[model samples]
Target: MQFSGFFSAAMMMIVLSPSLQSFPPAEAIRSSHLDSYIRLPSFQVSTSPDSQDDRFSFRKAFEFRNANECGFADHETTGVCDPTLVHVAITLDVQYLRGSIAAVHSILQHSLCPENVFFHFLVSETDMETLVRSTFPQLKFKVYYFDPEIVRNLISSSVRQALEQPLNYARNYLADLLEPCVRRVIYLDSDLVFVDNISKLWSTNLRSRTIGAPEYCHANFTKYFTNSFWSDDRFSGTFRGRKPCYFNTGVMVIDLVRWRRAGFTRRIE
Candidate 1:
């Protein structure tokens, strides 16, 4: 299960490769969706004074992970994990996007949502709306942006802090500002593209644990977590007590509400 921090930025998908259909440009797609959606320069977290508490539980959320150890052939879910209407949430820092513009456009096209699903893209304030609008305007996905100060609070402030929780940096606000109903949020990076349908990746459960994902538990798995995450008694205890089921964060389906309930975030934070 050699999934590193890079995979978070790389593997936002799980489907197999396409037959190379000539999909329209992302800009064109954005135009189609926004024509119906409220037009805006950028997206930001919306709040309402009338907001009510809508907490979550282990009953509502699930976790999934991607691992190179098993490769594509062995990556299929077992019999217990075959469900429909599964939802997934992915978080990306558009600033981390690299490679050619065409590559980024291609990755956005792979979002495996026919209808009624979420693929959350968390971009920077300085980034232009045109960057994404022109890139992936077709998918009716939600994109949000935060000012530098807010982003500072939402993501790690530095590399040193990031090493403490490589995957945690992008989700800095999960422990704080996440909506009360947000029981689980699957944190995903934007670097990789999907080969298989995302629903296939979302159908599984995490069993009784509040968190579940394929462990990057091998010796190599150590790179993604901060010394703090690796040193936590729960993680270490789980490591020694169980079969070393380390997890890669790329395709994680999390239960934020449950994690908060069990003080799981407090444990890692």
Candidate 2:
């Protein structure tokens, strides 16, 4: 079941970002109106022409359309902030490109509203957008470059070398990396497939929580920390009044609105 070699080898996550105050009246988010709400400087993706030497290639997937009940007709528009749109984010890297493609294909193949799903790909490498475009053909997606330097020093050695990649930490900065209008996002690891409709997962009611994911309260979470961390009451005692369960960041429903209001990016750092 392992898609790639890393801990908890097979898993999925969805994240939903909630609003801090009142939600916006309009359901649609247009790129033109972003200037008023954009708080972070936009990151750049490489525009170099696709090279023949590029290491990966994928066959074009059949275009999937929305079912009649969905009532979605905005496919002509390229807006990423559409409330009806399901925002799913995944990190893209050459090391796991195969898994990433398979995940996307599975989502599209099983989704009830395939066209309504928008992908927000986070990456440290360049020229991947081109590859994705060629493969999906009619896929709705945008690529955002995650500067490795932003999290380079913050990352430390891990049990697996793949865990050491700076892009592995890109999920922490997603609230800042995505458009301010993207309030909710499903952050997925590029290593799993969806056999059921993703909309079912998207419709999960997070209620007042910032993020939602499968919780394993029975797991020995303490083993994740170091001896010094366990010895220090300041660090260990932070969980004293709470029941923290082991949750995979890979599959999460993140409320970006709640994340931005709480300054989660800075908190994670």
lDDT of 1 at 11: 44
TM-score list, all predictions: 0.47, 0.72
Stretches > 4 Å off in candidate 2: 1-56, 217-245
- Provide the overall lDDT of each model, using Cα atoms, as 2-decimal numbers: 0.41, 0.71
Worst 10 residues of 2 by lDDT: 24-33
lDDT of 1 at 110: 48
Error of 2 at 76 (Å): 3.2
Segments of candidate 1 deviating more than 4 angstroms: 1-88, 91-95, 99-112, 124-129, 145-168, 175-178, 221-245
- Encode model 2's per-residue lDDT on 1-269: one tens digit a residue: 11222322233332112551242211111122232243222322222237333333456677898899989567566498788899999988765665677789889999988999999999898778877887788999999999999887877532234456799899998898999989899988875677778887787678888888765556454655566766788877877867776676778889889989999889889
